[model samples]
Target: MSATFVDVEDVRQRLGSFGVWIAPMTLLTTPVATQRAQFARIESLGYGSLWSGEPPADSPMGGREAFAEHGVMLAATERIVVGTGVANITRRDPAAMHSGAATLAEAYPGRFILGIGGQTGDSPLSQLRAYLDGMDAAATQVLSETAYPRLLAALGPKTHDVAAQRTHGVHPFMQPVEHTANARRLLGPEPLLIPHQFLMLNEDAETARGAIRSVFGSDAGLPNGFYANNFRRLGFTDDDLLDGLSDRFIDAVLAWGGRDDIVSRSRAHLHAGADHVLLHPIAHDLTAAVDQLELLAPLLHN
Candidate 1:
């Protein structure tokens, strides 16, 4: 199960040390021309990659299909690498996922990365292994020149083991710096380890805490047990998970306050052994998120 299909060096060379993960569905509601302009602006801001989570289409937020959105965003921008923070595997069959990823890789070449996760399933590790097997079979038919680089939405040790054995790397979302260090230890040094770091630009402490609560409050209820377990592993008590997350927990998971604070948090991940940190800035409006990115551009390592 060696990950011979992935070109890890090339992926690291392309993604660099920092990226932005804004909800792609946010742009779906806007005019197409405006969406293109915003993506272009992000590329100009010096972020190395653009990542998006795949929300359910029936959800109130109106999630677009990840591959379709990736195609649109990739076409809209010139150089910034575009990826799925994670595209859930349970939503579609493996053949469909493989074909879609292959198509994007063929069309976009090095600019696309497909990150897959199991949203709800029995034994996530077993399900992912089957999915990757299917993807390999599908790739032989659909891909002739190059295989697309992929990542697993892995957090725990078992999942991380599966990722290191089967895919290019692990994309651990909503994890703290300690988790980053632990994941790197499990993933070893060569595989790609791109962890997501939440950010809030508000200068006031309460305002930033409020922003954190607003964005991640629902995670405690997510069907997957990953978040709660990871928090406990980081020494967060049940009390910390309640009442809009304890102050210490919020501070650990989010980078808030001024620009320096956000930059410092992001740097902590890199120092903890992350190959790259995907910044998920918390803001009520898309424009505000872009503003945060603008402020962060100067501080990020190129």
Candidate 2:
């Protein structure tokens, strides 16, 4: 896909690396009314985008309409870009994914951004590589003629390079600031670098860590070694994964505490060169997640 290059400086000035992702499972689990409310609230909070993660499923809603719902949410306001923090390359053919993204872009105008990534869970390496290669082709095809900005949910070196060469930049999850720094270097001074960070707000170290572990335990064993290996690279031992997050481990990876504390941690990523920070609150309750956003507003609004 051919794409007009997004000005790295423009994206950085506007976003400052602080977008948020509402995973599909989480969004579906939350009542539709509540999700709509959440979208409106997030836009009002001055966030740049409402990101969605699509799982590999043979469903229509899992396609463009998912993020378009986010655009509809943005219609309730004036700013805020909406994006599929990623639609897997494995699930849709590039032509189809490109068409869906282009359609959404046409529907929403500049309010849409396209983010793509490799599928996690179980898939053969050969197939995964094909998917990544397809991503490169699809991104070029989509962006070749349009102005839509593209990002990759990269987890390692090669994927990171793909982000630099073919797309706008990278959006890494379950990664440390160290990776953010590395990503910036690889993408150079021109790519839009945004990384998603898990968030919480408890002061008691163990309590905060436990919440993370509960989520991680369920998500970590997926076929992708990216998350688990990244944890180890950040000093987390396998033993740390068996039960729950250790205080030391959680302190290293998650952003927790008061509004100022969380904002400070978020800043660390920006300082490391992320153009946008995609916030994923570690909570199930919609109200609780909104509360976390409220806590974050004071820090981010300035």
Candidate 3:
């Protein structure tokens, strides 16, 4: 799409200063009632939004339908916003993505955001831009005009510009405050800039970093993926990335240790120019995730 207009200020206001972003692998396995209650509790706790990561169907990450989970999240909450952190475009046709998002938007109105990305090719940037074109064409056929914002998962400067022009703004994942600052500088001021911060509550560095590595993989080997390359651009050395993720890089990206410390890290994103920040707690299960959010709730006052 070629920058269809959206109320950027409204989106910024609804997102608030801090919110939760999680894949909810464990919760997806639970009963409908249980999932509904927990999501409602998070809304009751005053979270501005809930964002879920969508792994492609049949992948080890475990999920086929991002839209179904989004529907449940929206239905359970009376106020809090629900969104895909970034629904991979490769997983579904543009028409399907647009209609599904429009359906939710028609139901919940401003409470739904459709964030999309995950393109791979010799020219990933060109691929994503083309994907947006497809989505734009699909928007012509969407029946209802119920409004919602769209955000791109961008890292490089060019993609960031594309995001600013083509969508509301960007939803950057697994990046540090420095990246947020750079993005803000590139985007000027009005565009929505929500950076996803990874969090672990452990006090022990070894154990905490181990958990992150297991989830992220590619400790000693494997191709340098999108995230690792972004880290490199941020000045993280190969050594920092290769040694099961060095303490230096981990310390930059993860909000761990004291509750105050985590809050401080999130605030740094705000100071660096993030309109909002989504904190994803990498916990053992759903209960631990909720506990972590509850623990941070008081400190994250908007």
Candidate 4:
């Protein structure tokens, strides 16, 4: 049997003209209880989807029972879709991933979205294609039992094509709006085109730059060399990398300042052809994140 994508009408309803991307609550930082609260709050705030991750440190197969904890969050809210914006493909055997994503979809019905990604390495293409094949077989097996949606956390042509041919859409991370335009052109009109936007609500030059630097300093030169290299292509120099994100680089990559400023930057992503925008607040403070969401809620509607 062929693999099943998400039901278009169902996805459209869940999207309801507003799509959201949220940061994953990592094991070190946000606890499950805290994650539940945050997801519930974001759902109340009118965001459409809550996205999280299964990083390398976590179990690779992306457990279905893990999301079961968030059942409290899902139960507390209505109309929000919950996604594993990427549970890495390399971490799990095909059957394990299939069972995990399948269980979540069966349990939640239309509310679950499974997003998959390839882990970083030299032979990423070979590994990613194999992962896609496994993911397809998994989806077929699960969708035979029940319907669910899947997406790929894609950055390049090959994965984007896999997402187009196999799943519902593509969710590209840390990419600029121009990338969104290019991805839309690649994925065409039918699939979901959700992009993650990092933001800071402070306009103070030093404070914003410090925040961006702090965030990127921790992330750059990591295993994901491609993402860092892409930033270089976007004009980040060695100085920018060593000193951390320059003001220009920060401004180029992140949306910063007050509500109006953030919304204006987000509009560019939507205008560039994104079907949905997920906002990742760079702030460590939860209240600040919530406040930013409150401020950005109006923009989500438009």
Q: Please report, in order, the local distance difference test score of every candidate based on alpha carbons.
A: 0.81, 0.70, 0.82, 0.69
Candidate 4 runs further than 4 Å off: 17-20, 25-28, 57-72, 139-143, 218-224, 232-242
* Candidate 2 least-lDDT 10 residues: 215-224
Q: How many clashes in each structure? A: 0, 13, 1, 1
lDDT of 1 by residue, 67-160 (tens): 8877878999988899998887856887788878878887887898889885555676776788888877776665545577789998889889
lDDT of 4 by residue, 153-176 (tens): 888777778778777888888888
Ranking by TM-score: 3, 1, 4, 2
Residue lDDT tens for model 2, 232-278: 66566866644454566667678888777888888899899887888
How accurate locally is residue 271 in candidate 1, as Cα lDDT from 0 to 100?
98
What's the lDDT for residue 248 in model 3?
A: 83
lDDT of model 1 at position 157: 92
- Each model's Cα RMSD: 2.2, 3.7, 1.9, 3.4
Which regions of candidate 3 deviate over 4 angstroms? 1-4, 218-223
Clashing pairs for model 3 are 1-132
Spell out the clash pairs found in candidate 1. none
Give me the candidate number with maximum TM-score. Answer: 3
Candidate 2: lDDT of 124? 36
